[model samples]
Target: MGLWLPNLEYLNLGSNQLVGSFPMSISNASRLRVLNMSHNYISGSIPDTLGNLRNLEMLNLEANNLTSSGMGFLSSLTNYPALELLSFGDNELISGELPGSLGNLSSTLQIFFAARCNIRGSIPDSVGELINLVSLDLSANNLSGDIPRSLEQLRYLEYFNVSFNRLDGKILDGWSFGNWKNIANLDFSGNNFSGAMPDRICDLNSGLRYLGLNDNQLEGALPLSLINCTDLVILNVAKNRLSDTFPHWLGALPKLRVLVLSSNRFHGSIQDSIATSFFTKLQMLDLSSNAFTGLLPTNFFHNLKALSEVVEYEYDNYRYSVNVTIRGLELPFTITVAIPVFTCIDLSNNGFHGEIPEAVGELSMLLALNLSHNSLTGPIPTSFGDLAALESLDLSFNKLSGSIPSQLTSLTFLEVLRFQNNNLVGHIPRGKQFETFENKSYAGNLDLCGFPLSKECSNGEGSETEKHDQVNGKGMAFIWKVVLMGYGSGLVFGISMAYVVFTTGRPWWLVRMIERDLKEKIRSWIPKKKRN
Candidate 1:
């Protein structure tokens, strides 16, 4: 095994239990372009002689217990002209300033990853000189101070992450990040940066497909400029202090597939305009923990062809959620957006009201549907039985009423059925699918019965028809009680009037005249109405 090929251009000894410091003999391969020695128990300082490999392009020494001497060895790499990709992540090196000479590698450098290296102090402004850099990740470190304004010069950067750091400063404004239109991913989450997101963060990058800016102090409205990035597939701006009405600009993006805007201060009704036809390719949409409210458009799922495919099949636990504002109230309205073509949909913790759409049954390929913690009402749609592929269904903490549809028993593949805290009634079906669920699945229901609960049918037997009749009888009784109460009150009032007429000798005209005289006196004493 020691008889190695002298012409080896790449040597990968990563993730093995290789002990001891990097073998200085590795420098013998003068033509080696790639050297990966990551995720091992490798100790001791990197040999400074590594800089002798003038043709080396990539050098990775991550995930080891290297000391300050090891870091000093990396400083020697400042002389290597062809060194393009360098990684020194997840090491125990003490805090130190990056050498300014790192800027000298501007000619051919493409990637520089130094995450979790415990390096502190301000990021060197010289880093902006790496004009040829395409990917730069320095996350999970203690680097602080304003991100260098000079970073805007990196026109070729495609993937950049500076998250989990103490960087503070307004994100550079008007910088042409869009210049890197070919960039597909960018993450700056978990930082202390404060200020409105740069208005042009995505201005030039129409081809950008993913952007994450969560867990920051970003304020102001969502940048309307993002609409220009029509190719975005994932956009996460959650857990920030963003304040504005719902971002209407998002509806313009044709290729957007995932949108997460939760935990912000956005307030407004989920506009019907945005719900009508946009988001044709959206698969995961989370607008939770906001002040959006409104009746979700009935046809909200129509334009999403992927959703429609799920609804057309027989599946189970199909889930979909819509956050909205209704009548000045914040609410989350959720449904089994799970159709036969999708797996899950979550619309919990919003201000949605109204009946669950029966069209949800068309999601035959759905696996899980969560519509919990909302103001939704009406009966569980019997069409839900069409979802044969469903596994988990959560519809708890809503105002839903009526009996659990026996058709739900058709979901033979269901594993978790959650409908707690709803006003559901009637005997729970004790069939193949129903028998598998426990009391926890149907707990908060006052009128729910059957195999899971001790409450039997009205006839003290598990009779399906008897249970249905019992539910019907309760409904009838409720209606009659209301009607009878109104009728009885009317009868009482009529009897009292008759008694008054019989007992009083005064005519009706005399009573009316007295009342009119009093009203005229009162009106005369009052001031005249003012003009608007």
Candidate 2:
């Protein structure tokens, strides 16, 4: 707790288990330029005394239990003109409202993060004063009210996030982004936003790589102008009120990797993209719980080269993450493009009808596939056996017919297999992963008979209609005969007993038999301890 080093220019004690309140004595290090105490157990108010370091360039106190009544300490930071970054995220600051003077900090500040700090109230309009900010995060807070229009002043901003807030109102007009030429990432997800999305978001077409607007009240069609974001990698607009046809034009964005449009009002068929390169780099595609109809786009999957090939990706702060429906559950997963392994395609809970394309099997690196709750018909493509890395496959609640291809038994890594409620007939595939499936996996398919099902397959391997009917008839007849015999025997015994009771009128023979039986039962019921 002794800060005698007057010339200390750099201090980084991040990612440690240090505890206790802010060290006020640190102010003695007047020459300290970088002070980082992040990822520690620090608590209590951040003392304004830290601002005494006139040469301070960076101050990071993120991921601590720090609290403050009014965050007045931010005003003291203005004393240092060289400050470039300030991070105080993931702390219970209890700062009911950010001070308007927050915009008065050094103009050189390029990064500011106060996320999950129990911050409430509307964003102060003066925030626009920090025109040089490159990164700003205020996510997962109690922030509400409209975003101040003054934010448009941050022309040099590159990354911005205000997700998981209570902010409401229509999205800002396109002109708001006209000056944001350098904006690369912008996220407004998990908000109460409503109204049509502005097409002018493409104003930063050259540098915009990520745009997330999911879980909003947005309506109308996707802005076709988004096709201009040539550098866009991830575009998520799921769980909205949007109503539009599939924007085939989006496939033109060469770097687009993840596209999610689930739980929306999107309808109509996903037309074949004339561009052979459509979605070539795409790895995750989720279009479930929509009203899309017509055949599953064959050419679309044929062009999904990224799912079939081994392509490395650079790991950086831009790494994407999402909640995927795997085996009927929504699981969160971060996409590490560097791995070049896992891939998934979920089209469940849609109105799509038609045979699955054989081309899908070519995605040998695919890890999960979901086509459940659709009107799909025809046999499962045997090509599916080629998906060597597949772990979860769901094709249930469809009209699929014919035998399940035995080729599926080769999937050694398969853990979740669902094929229930289909027209599939014949013996279930045996060995390997198929044997691990329970009876529910083949339920509602009356014609399917095998080890898991109660209806055993005939030894002759009868799959034809005539043979199946014969087996069913014989089994039914045997059951009927046994039932009739039991009924007759019960009736005959009842009649004989009634006759004996009426004729004998409690005869001596009956009395003698009852007494002997009662004595034998009493002897057996005697306690073992007493007998001993």
Candidate 3:
């Protein structure tokens, strides 16, 4: 179109076969407000003159083959006092630093994104100059150096993500746990941030909701300050070097929904408060890959109102006596009580033994339950069928026995059911959700039979019991034959020994009689020999 529509306020030709450098004629559309030509075959540097559209408010030219020189095209947009949102993500642009001129944009700007553009170097301190910025995303870049402390100047900022960068240094003093009181979503994951968690992190209370600090070098005990943030919904601090007992303060957060503290150096018994008190609104909780022990509370699922509120509470009270009493009599009075509600609970990978509680199915809103890799025994509760919304259930590597619950087929929405490496017996349930699972899901249960497994159910003619009886009969027959042969051989040996001993007793007299008869015959024959 070559900017033929000068009156155009919005222009979008994205994902087309358009080619060549940006048309400089676009600068003629001084009234243009929105421009998008992303995912096209456009190449070469962006037109610096195109930024003359003073009324332009939103611009997206992402996912193209635009090169480094195109970065200069952005600096011209600073002249637009009305510009509010800008996105240049997912382009093969060369590495560069964020333009300091970006700080000069009008305070009316609300959203800014420059992810995956090879932008490197530290975030400019000038970023604090955009006081009205609400959402900022600089993720998936090569940016390095410390997160600027000046970021605390953004009092109105709500969502911020600097993940997947090479940024190093401790989380800035105020931003670490103190200043971001209005932040609802903060993702500093996939960075080189180090040091102990600041104590004031959870002091934001109802304002700070989702906190993701995983895959960092953060250490030290989980700060007790977390209990102060009664409005926290999701807390993820996985894959760090943190060392301490399981944090008990988690159970006190009134609104916590998802708590993931995996792959750390936490040790000690999983406190009963985990299951009995906290997590009332929890939907997904993963505490796997730690060194925890102790029996899981039997009533772990008893208090979950929606499988989300799984934190604990503190109670206190006071009493006083008044000096002026009615009718010249002295009187005193006192009252006390405080209660916290916790909903969902996950105590897997701990050394918990005994049967899973039937009350676990009471969590009607439970969506994902992972009790795998523990010492839990006994049959899976039939009550599990009551979880109408259950989506993912894993009970692998436990000592659980008995038949797979036929009622489990009621979990129509279940996408992942892992029950491997258990002692479960009986035929695998047929039809519906059971048939969808592969043999691996039911492996390590040698006594289990039916479809999906190689072993077939026993019939009357060749039942395992009948085969055992047949083998026992053959063994008895062989033993009896060996005994008869031994008795016959012993009789023959005894008879032969007795005959020899009796026959030799009269042998000497028989020898003398024979000698006298032989002497007479010899005397007659000797006389004839002498004559010869």
Residue-level lDDT tens digits of model 3 in 49-106: 8677888876767667777643577777777787776667667674577777673484
Q: RMSD, model 2, all Cα superposed?
A: 24.3
Estimated TM-score for each candidate: 0.74, 0.82, 0.72
Tens-digit per-residue lDDT, 205-286, candidate 1 = 5556567787889999977788878767667787789998776568668766557787788777664655566766665666
TM-score, candidate number 2 = 0.82
How much is 420 displaced in model 2, in angstroms?
2.0
Best candidate (score: lDDT): 2
Candidate ranking under TM-score, highest first, comes to: 2, 1, 3
lDDT of 2 by residue, 1-532 (tens): 7777998988878768999888889988999887878779998898888778888877878778888777777777865787777788778764877767653463877777778788889888877778878778888898999888888888887778898899999877545586688777778989999989877887656577778899989999998889889888778898899998887888889888878888899899986647888889887888988899999877888889888766555633343333344435444443422244236888899899989988887777677799999999998787777677676799999999977776676666676778899999887877777767799878888888987888988855554634543432222111101001110000001111221222334322212212333444434432232110
| Regions more than 4 Å wrong, model 2 | 103-106, 174-176, 312-317, 324-327, 336-342, 451-455, 462-532
- Candidate 2 clashes: the total is 0
In order, candidate lDDTs are 0.64, 0.73, 0.63
Q: Which 10-residue span in candidate 2 carries the lowest summed lDDT?
A: 482-491
RMSD values, in order shown: 25.7, 24.3, 37.1
